[model samples]
Target: MDRTVEHYERIAATYNEHWTYNPDYVRGFSHAITDALRLTASDAIADIGCGTGLYTRRLYEDVRPTRPILCVDPVRAMLDQIPASPGLQPLLAEAEDLASGRVALPDGGPLDAILLKESIHHMPDRRATFDGLAGLLSGHGRVLIVMLPKSIQHPLFAEAHERFEQLQPDPTEIADMVAAAGLRSSVSYRTFHAAVERERYVHMLESRYMSVLGEFSEDELRAGIDQFRHSYRDTPLLRFDDHFAFVKGWVPAR
Candidate 1:
């Protein structure tokens, strides 16, 4: 139980509303999770921190349903947002809450996929969390953790980037944490579509993640976002480059 997840538990309800689902974004990111899992019948996959089923619904549409897909999140409010679908099993459980042996499968086996999308940073104990995940995986199970880089490399985000730098995890540190979990895995990255749009991107940032921006004083937040906008005010929408990298890997087969 890390403080990160606890923080998410507090904001889970409004999180999804802030980041409206861009199907194109979901498809681009989820491709790796699906490709790594190589889903087929007889396989069960769980989307950890499956908030509002954004990616879950995307997976439901894109991937071939070989087995039941379980959507797991600690907050019930987030779980309640997931609309039911064929073979979609939405469960209310935090990352550390999966030890319940009662979780079942159609073939009475274990899970084949576990996706920790942008959720690992919030966790306090990475090793303990992954260790628990290892026990839940079937022989071929893989865990894919998707995340953004710690640094805001763009000039428009100078102030916000400064704060992000204070809170974000280092790549090497995160890699070391994963290795300490005693799992066999590899990491990869992909840039997001935001890599292209600066002004609209900043606007989206101001509108969508206001809570995150609001964490600072109103004057500071406004000054930061306003200055961020000014940095890109002359920048064209499509000309602005914003790429978010997702680090993905898997636990080797048992």
Candidate 2:
């Protein structure tokens, strides 16, 4: 199993719960997605690595798209969490499948929008992936990538930040990749906020809410949490900024 899939499997049950703790963050990012992807009435939309359909469900509710909203993910465990809905279609395929033509879209031709929120980094060969996705776009189709910066303001242990910086892809570089793939590309930034009870935030850290936290050993996690307790300002609510880098690519309308 892919290590990321394994990590999602371990946290699949709690993955949906992950959103509840950051309702504002969810709203901000989802709104940004709708605007960036212009999803008010997209004919066909796909959310690659649509983890448990947390954001997919939100997008569905907000946009109420007429056509099917495809939810794609490689991990069956995570894909299973997206409940049956009128317009939600769950596909068990990795991003590479779409890139390599191994998996076909419903219409087998064009897609109005393709989303790679927080999942682009997991794609092993992004250049080819971008090339393939660019080919899949309808006349007015678009691909939007939402990802993290190298550093974050979240109250994680110091080492977790280091690990994230090592793994996180620079958004400008990804935008350049899109341009090199022969599509019009642009890069932008969006910031969101999360306010949760301090204990809930601590639990999130313990749950290893992100991949960076997954790297810590059990003892290291405990120590990190302990440090967080001591170091973070003693307060009922934990508030922090979440920074998202957006890279958008599209084929010009023909």
Candidate 3:
């Protein structure tokens, strides 16, 4: 987890640029997330592992504009990239730390929702972390874990897909973890399509848009790009099959 934080810190400056090529795609995903969670303007939410505040900002704009959100991440550089706003509070903390109370939320009464977006895989202990987060919720609070399951195919880079499969947890496993944390949980699936120009997609691959790409060697990356160019030479746009799972755990009202 420490090394993962370092990697994100190094790439924090340009991280949001990875998704800039498709604004509608991002907006759609955010809308789906907001709908799935049934978030309201009065709900107090926390976006854990919110890198560069991409989705965090979207949540504010598309869902709960007036609500204050706590954006937490282990990387200070990533947190720094989040724009300064009265509604968005940046906290320097890891998932496990937040769960264990090593890091505390800023004097808010209680959180109505805690969102773990593409971040659960990075935590050291999944069950313990979930248990900790469960402790922080308000009586009716829910913990939402948004993730890309291992079953989905990565369209651009094979190496990144392989690494994702190696790290991603199964949806059932996450649900069980939530249940073990003493919360009743359910899982739902959604598909988001991101259409990017072939050239831009290749550029994102070459720039190592995902942390998984960092594991590939320079030669391997070049080879992957060559393979992509050959495979999509005739296709001007690449449509990514972005399949995701929303695992929700409810904290019963006291």
The models' CA-based lDDT, in order, is 0.63, 0.85, 0.83
Question: Per-candidate TM vs. native?
Answer: 0.78, 0.95, 0.93
- Tens-digit lDDT track of model 1 for 1-254: 54444445555566665446454656765675566556555567788878778777777666757766888777676677777777678877767667434444335547777777767766666767767776777766666777666765555356666777776676666666656665565556556554445655555565434224545665775687777667667766543334444444456544
lDDT of 3 by residue, 1-254 (tens): 56687678778888888897788878888888788777888888999999888988999987654667889988999999998988899989888888888887787448888889998888778887888788888888888899878766556556666777887789889988998888888999988887788888787887777777777789998998888788889989877678899999997656
| Model 2 TM-score relative to the real fold | 0.95
Candidate 1 overall Cα lDDT vs. reference?
0.63
**Best-fitting candidate, scored by TM-score:** 2
Index of the highest-lDDT prediction: 2
Model 2 agreement with the true structure over 112-228: per-residue lDDT tens digits:
898999988887888888788788888888899999877888878787888888988899899999899877899898988777787888888888889778888899989988888
- Cα RMSD of predicted structure 3: 1.8
Q: Of the candidates numbered 2 and 3, which has the greater TM-score value?
A: 2
| Inter-residue clash pairs, candidate 2 | none
Error of 1 at 161 (Å): 0.7
Q: C-alpha displacement of 104 in model 2, angstroms?
A: 1.4
Model 2 lDDT, full chain set? 0.85
Worst 10 residues of 1 by lDDT: 238-247
The 10-residue segment with the lowest total lDDT in model 3: 151-160
